[model samples]
Target: MAKRAPGLGAVQETMLITLHARARCGDEAAARLVEAIDYDFAPMQRNAGATELFHVLRCAALDEWTRQFLAECPHGTVVELGAGLSTRADRLDNGTAHWCYVDLPDATELRRALLPDGERRRTITGSVLEDGWADAVAADPGPYLFLAEGVLVYLEPAGVRRALTTVATRFPGCRVALDTHGEWIVKRSRGPLTRMAADLVWACEDPKALQDWDLGLTLRESWPLSRPDWVVRRALPRHTRLTLAAVNAFVPRRMTNSRVNLYSVDATG
Candidate 1:
């Protein structure tokens, strides 16, 4: 096992939950990292069934979106905000695109120790609320794709607006892919097995509300967890697919309102 590093904050530690899920789903890189880490994954492992499936499905949707962006802009830059032990760069490298992973200092420290950085791949240590990191990302090629995956929900509403506004202003015409929790989901996410110590703070009932914020964002697509796009649905196991179908048929929409959203940054922002 690798040497244990200093403890991560409550929110940062949650990355291990997604990491564990990816490992359980047969990701060789994730599995290797899981074996190398010294932390006790027992708590995260206990919630493995549906939670793991949902996590992977969400990742699949984002991967497909990223692939689409790379197809159009092969030399474009991809920046993952609040990236935590994410194997996305490894999984989606197209040889020519630049990849930058940004997160808190300690999380970046741990990630750098475990993941290799190359001429095209690098890590930036900073929070999304800061402006310094944007300059480094802007220095890369154009037509950027910024992914905030499972990061922003922990922030207060004001922070979310500020972060998105910064991205809109700095990288106009770029694409941003992020996940949001509805008010209902945010309320329930505080359950014992769900979020542990990091409670979700922002609650967006509809992604359209983001457009109303005057942040120069135009929602292109939003996929609810219960109803992922065909690409993500077909890739799921039969049992998982059946379960999602049942949820779509029976579960209240409010309960499953969390979504993966894609937005286009207005060029005139």
Candidate 2:
């Protein structure tokens, strides 16, 4: 029998994409589940080298941020918009915090299939574009944290704007960590790195524009997402390694491919 093709539906594709990334980095759950998804993803998994390493590192950074948020707001609620198949709640679980994984109905079904709901964790079938999901999250006591990883880039500029403003308006004292592409990638829609995944139709060259949304959002940090040092030393070609070093040394901000931005919403938006 021929190998089954990987499913590439919206939202569902990201689950596979992130799973491939984690499995490539030897995440046991990701590794075990990849094959069980009914496809031979070995070729895609093999190609995951640097991209996988960077994604895994990005996830680690988010996990750390969540840890800090939990420490500060011990009973905080976390809402993961476009949750896909992420195990972040499991990875970042504090004993008291509540987690809601929000996504379209289909994706939520897949999420529920893989991970059972617990006392503190539940999956909600809904879109961030809609209103009720956030309200449900608000019903729980919170100093909230929202994650939009690999999500906003797919939304149009207006949709992204509305989503951000809505969060600020509805959940004051919330923190959001989202991934975005630079204008170059958004306009060209053709980069070696981005070409590996689904096309990212939305991009923001100036994160400062987001602040101007009049949503009372503070740009806490916007950092380039890159492969870890050990991954570079171990896996990258010699010239690629040299090029990365030069970029980091001379023009770090020119890293326009990928970024993970963290923002804080004002209590009086």
Candidate 3:
């Protein structure tokens, strides 16, 4: 599909679907699941090339992490922050859990093309920074995993804080897993390498900035979600590892987060 008209800036949307298309294709069930969802135009293709590889790698990591979470947590809810045209539900559908697609209204419009309105799997068409959307999700036990794959940097730093604060409040004791960029992105802004790495986004020098907003999230793990095996297996085997590493080099090296350190009487605490 063509990219969403410029201003809507569906860069996250495009990246997710391309990741869905390329990464989810790993298994037949996943491929069928992806084929089942309709993709927004151009969100993936418009930015395909090297940058898209990061999208693919991240999607794979997300899929693996989701699988891990479900196996570990009981009937957990998987909230895809800025879930644009991604068939993540297809790859990791376990019938018994809840899967919510979160994103802007326009991106959801593109998502509805394939996802359809449903029962177990549904859509929350709003920025994660907003409220109400959390209320829309069915309540589960403590420590919900709010995942933000490639959406945070595009948001104003404060917007990200608001989103985290909301999630931390709504789901007390919830742990979040997200990917973020490093200090170098904000500090060094020059050359094609910078352009290749930084294209319309912001990075954080310290991971704890989320806590500064009074959100009760704590850092869990911050390791590279790199997959040397998968990269080596790609058709262009020659450059896949090098390519993946080059992209990953820009990511903050640890699992940066703030946990539900202490819960106030209100979930918002």
Candidate 4:
């Protein structure tokens, strides 16, 4: 069993929910690994109505995005920033794409133990705010898709901007997909798991505004977290659904809910 810190491990519990959700849906790989963990994730399901569904949807979106990349550029690189216990590389391996997992030392250590490296996949231990990690991925030639799943919110606005600019400068014409909370979500931003001590420091109401952070980048698309399938929607209260629909209709660009956003940056040459 992997040693775990009590409160600190709380943020990682989000990944556990993803694993459990996937496992129940007959993902053998996710199920096999999830069986080793000893944590009661039931509370997560009860408290967070659509947590599992959102993860499933996000994984599906990322899978398609990754497939599209591999189809175009077989030798393309994929970087998972703040990769906790995500088995995305294993799940979406295209046989030729190189994959890099970047995270803090402890998280990377855990990842190494759970999912050992292979010829095309490796782990880099570092903060996304730093310089060296970008260089680590730079070894692989052109066209990278950086996925920052549950990251970014923990960073201050300046740090987020710096990271984005650094990526654009380093990889040039790379694509980035990340999740961010809105102003309202940030105000009440306690992590979904009670034990997880996540202090979300930045909130962007408009993802398009991120373009101003760096000249090379432009927001490609944004998918609201609440916009799950009908099966998940039925779990939400009727009023909540109505309100979200109303918000979607009124301010299409405003991120009243958390969203996964994609950005494309031009080469800085």
Best by the lDDT measure = 1
Whole-model Cα lDDT of every candidate shown, in order? 0.86, 0.72, 0.58, 0.73
Work out the TM-score per prediction: 0.96, 0.83, 0.68, 0.82
Ranking by TM-score: 1, 2, 4, 3
Instruction: Tell me the lDDT of model 3 at 235.
Output: 37
- Give, for candidate 1, the lowest lDDT window spanning 10 residues: 188-197
lDDT of 2 by residue, 1-269 (tens): 33334444654566677777777666677665675576556656556654565576577667667888899998988888888778776566779999988888777776676676889888888777777787777778888999987788888888898888779999987999887777765665431234345667787776766888888888997666653335324555576567556656775464445777789999876
Clashing pairs in 4: none
Q: What is the lDDT of residue 150 in candidate 1?
A: 85
Q: Candidate 3, residues 1-269: lDDT per residue as tens digits?
A: 53333223535434444444474336454354454545443444454554445455556666666777777775778887887666777767787767888888777776676458676777888878788788776453334566787677666777877787777767776657676666554344332223233353556655655555666666654444344334323633457677656656674444222111111212455
Candidate 4, 147: how far from true, in Å?
Answer: 0.6
The better candidate by TM-score, 3 or 4, is 4
Q: What is the lDDT of candidate 4?
A: 0.73
Model 1: lDDT of residue 52: 72
- For model 2, the local distance difference test gives 0.72
> How much is the lDDT of residue 269 in candidate 3?
57
Per-residue error for 264 in candidate 1, Å, reads 0.2
